[model samples]
Target chain A: MSKHLLIVSTSTVYGKGYLGYMEEEIKNFFGENKNIVFIPYARPGGISHDEYTEIARKKFEELGLSVKGIHEFENPKKAIAEADGFFTGGGNTYVLLKQLYENGLIEPLRNAVENGKPYMGTSAGSNITGLSICTTNDMPIVYPPSFKALQLVPFNINPHYLDPNPDSKHMGETRETRIKEFHFFNDQPVVGIREGSWLEVMGEDVTLCGELSARIFEQGKEPYEVPTGSKIKF
Target chain B: MSKHLLIVSTSTVYGKGYLGYMEEEIKNFFGENKNIVFIPYARPGGISHDEYTEIARKKFEELGLSVKGIHEFENPKKAIAEADGFFTGGGNTYVLLKQLYENGLIEPLRNAVENGKPYMGTSAGSNITGLSICTTNDMPIVYPPSFKALQLVPFNINPHYLDPNPDSKHMGETRETRIKEFHFFNDQPVVGIREGSWLEVMGEDVTLCGELSARIFEQGKEPYEVPTGSKIKF
Candidate 1:
């Protein structure tokens, strides 16, 4: 079976509850699956692993799905292999990848997702689905052995991507400028998934989901905005 | 002899010419040094090394200083060691560190600065003056051999740091939140140098420079603002 993924841009959009906007779609995405192996390695606000897992569990329980953190298992690799579905929450990408590498769960997680076990990721979790975490917006709090990631998708995912505010006085590089710099070093295409937007990956198709449009960056070409519900072709 | 470093937060503040804000201070910082080697590996906007260097050269010429690009030298390590002073312009920190390591210029540059030679950096350039580039705001467009930097200073520096806008609708983590997440993994104290402000290092003293207050983030302590010209401790 081909891969199925829900790559969410963020866990909570502005003024929304945690994972609120995509709850219904997420529930239907893993229909009949009652238990999800939660990867709380990202740990937003530096919350404890158990605390982060509990937040995810509470959200999933509302949809009749129980959640268990990968850390709760003695063997994380085995836990991912036997998991009915997976939910990777967002926080810091560097720390999450570091733990993923240290636990030797990269291959097992990839295999599970490739074998049709549904997988959903928000922010840093969604970032891991790309070829590398080079485009992440998080601080490099920790360093992983490699920038290479799970390669679940053909392009890079820049979660929670925002457009530059024209009225702002800050002089930092804009999101568009940063992505263009990425093109300078790599040839991979990048998808700038905006807030409340996500990539819904079915067997062989990836569709842009949500109300807002997403930006697509290709090397040596102008980045263009694509409407929501549009299919993405790498 | 102790090092003399000028760690600027940005090359050009908004609506200012390149290096315009600190030109006179930079001139006095060098104190009759006629030649300065320029490291343009950061290459903002993905410009070529020569193009980036010329921009620096033009700015320095106004101060009656001669400039040479490190890339133009046959032996980059030798060029760094023989230079009267050093100037690292800002761009992508990853690309800058990668080149520094790849060309074996890290040790040479560090030695020159530690030996009391004047060295200046802006944005990504200044980020390297700290223990590591972990706190940079730039995108990781490329992977470097290591995240280790010059270690010219004990703590890490967060360049172009901006406070969160209370009225904004953006959902991304604020700079302060990102740095706090950094503290969860590492114990290094981080200095958030905002635009138009910089750190002046002479001998063993490090003082906040310019007209604005800089934010300081220490482990387990609330971030405090240090006024201009105040000496920083811890």
Candidate 2:
């Protein structure tokens, strides 16, 4: 496994506004050979494979990066071994995890990444890289046999977060409060990632991408916000 | 503090509806007169103090339990300290946790429960008894200075569950799948309390209630469900 990696937020769809810094980071990570053995199979949000593959294909074309075959390998064994690096796309993280776990691909992917194969997870893809898939907001539209995630990353990641809703009179519990409640019972950090941002990890060190500001929470301390340009080491 | 505690799921409206079994449990834990104090101060979900207090007053009336005036004390310090046992009501858990944290009632409540005060957290009330306050589906209509909860229950609880969406197309993650995904980052169990169902904890042991079922999850295992008659040890 190669140590270089990039977990994207979402692959551009026909060139809307670009996630400038994040796109640049991907280029920087891969450097000269931006070409990748793209695996778009993780688009498990009930989206059709054609549409999902097209999203990635367009990105590579638009970004001026070299195109590689979009692998349609259905089984995990074939897909995991033949790849140099992997980039799983975003959609329904539950679906992504379900496919990976059901096919027994989680460990294989982990091994591939550990041995230095560059593994990049985007959105739903990014969700599976974590130790538990608990942080995702993706609705489980379908039912899988079990509820387990690829236990790779040590902490849970909450992607695409805005601040707490201020005006909804529900005053009930907000998503933030709910997550905080999770921390109260269990001591684990749930990384709240804003749009256009993703986590880049090498070995154990993880860096915040795109936006410098993100909120990090553990169980015992006060909930603090990460300021722009601050170095967050975990 | 009494060791035997009976946490009611509701007072009426939703009674969260199981006063009869709860009464039996309360009596089973200690005799009927366990010196119960109504901790109505935790209904934090955006309701005005007057509205919350009214709900408290009503719960008191229907449950036939005297209101010990925890909310009226003005000082959480005096009220929480004076109370020997507690009965938390159901409402918006985020609001309840916010009020509890803002008023500095969390510590007192934690102490009382940990020291064996027979803490009974129902619905929103039960949610606060856990670690943090982020697992709820309720909106955060209000903001207190902090996001903290009384660290009593081990996992985040989602009380008052009904039917699932009828027309849903997303795959892999069902309503249940999404909550299980939350467990990836949060190791504490996510207890799904379907109406009359609840969790009855005594010392090191805990039991499930209601004729319905509850869902619980840990790190590595699948999200397994427990029915009304199940006894789960967390």
Candidate 3:
């Protein structure tokens, strides 16, 4: 048993139905694991866990899989241990991580995933698979006990990575600039995945998927891009 | 003596020299308080405190004020108590707040401002004058001890607030959506100040300054805009 994860930048791409853009890949990733424990901690739009879980359940059902929200279980830790697969949806990363910590599911879920329980995450979900949630673009609507995340990957994930708009008049720090600031105090490498792109990790191997090139920011190095299908070697 | 503060959305508006756009207002806000202590903890672009202070010193020098970085003092608390005024330049809010806590400056600075120290803040600086840094637009590269801030105003300030672009194909949550998510977990009202705009606070009175309108988001109420110079009552 080895690590198997599908870390997605977004659950829904612009103009695409929920998970429609990655339907083929998702189906392939789940394979025969039909019972997915949906971690709806990252409730996008602040929807309830049950409501967010239903969105994932309906989408997974179309692919012949059954989904259940982790909150629906009597014991979330036990639920993680017994689940055949996992799917964490996107929302506010801080809220999701806070709930995960509060439920004490971080270790259980990490153990399950490390033992080859299939895991899929989009945006905020994808963020936790990294070293820490420090690079996430989501607001700190809530505070997690720690920025430390499940070390499923050696690097951090910056979801929804946007290129600088040279024509814009906005003074907000660009995604690249923000990451640069992170490197000032942090030493971890950050993989910035754009919309419609994802990282497919099988055991020790991690590769960039989808049609777009992903940006890589390493501490003390100039940020660069790795084309689709390239191995993300930090 | 009364609460006197200048909370700005951004330190520099697009196409304007740093502090150039609000020279008159900044001068008026400072009045005859010429000796200023600058908090460079935000450290935009990861510059050292001394380097960041140099930037502010040069800018304020144009206005006939002598600026010194707080880091220069052996006792920061004493520096706050003895300074004629204060100016906190913008960078990363988490970093700023974290350093403030690390140095035990939050209480001193808040008390100083409450006693009419003529405090001015741009971006991250402006954010701390509010109830919490939960509504900031900066990345949480570093975790502060707490999200609690100066509470100079009753509401949170979402500095560098941008309106949703109807034409955007990107799926990231808009500023409005993010603030809405914030309300789901916290009850504090949020003031979304755009670039070139600021809030002028005199005692308990807070009025929107600059030429642009500011958006206000209150829990359970739809976000609405109040024109420039309008008293932000909600």
Q: How much does each candidate deviate at the interface, measured as C-alpha RMSD after superposition?
A: 0.8, 11.2, 0.7
Candidate 2 accuracy as lDDT: 0.59
DockQ, candidate no. 1: 0.83
Candidate 1 residues A1-234, lDDT tens each? 788999999989889899898889998998987789999999888999999999999989998899999999999987887789999999999999999999998988988999989999999999999999999999988889998999999999999899999987788899999999999999999999999999999877999999799999999999999999999996
Q: Give per-residue CA lDDT, model 3, range B1-234, as digits (tens).
A: 998999999999988999999998888888899999999999999999999999999989999889999999999998998899999999999999999999999888998899889999999999999999989888889888899999999999999989999999899999999999999999989999999999999999999999799999999999999999899875
The local distance difference test score of each candidate is 0.92, 0.59, 0.93
- Which segments of candidate 1 are over 4 A away from where they belong? none
Cα deviation at A23, candidate 3, in Å, is: 0.9
For candidate 2, lDDT tens digit of each residue in B41-89?
5444334455655655554455555446566676767876776567777
Per-residue CA lDDT of candidate 1, range B48-148, in tens?
A: 99999999999999999999999999999888777999999999999999999999889989999999889999999999999999999988888888888
Best by DockQ: 3
The collision pairs in model 1 are none
Which sequence of candidate numbers ranks them by lDDT, best first? 3, 1, 2
Q: After superposition, how far is residue B112 of candidate 3 from its true place, in Å?
A: 0.9
Count the clashes in each prediction.
0, 38, 0
Model 2 over residues A112-168: C-alpha lDDT tens digits?
777777766667777666666655665433334444455566777766555674643
Residue B138 accuracy (lDDT) in model 1? 85
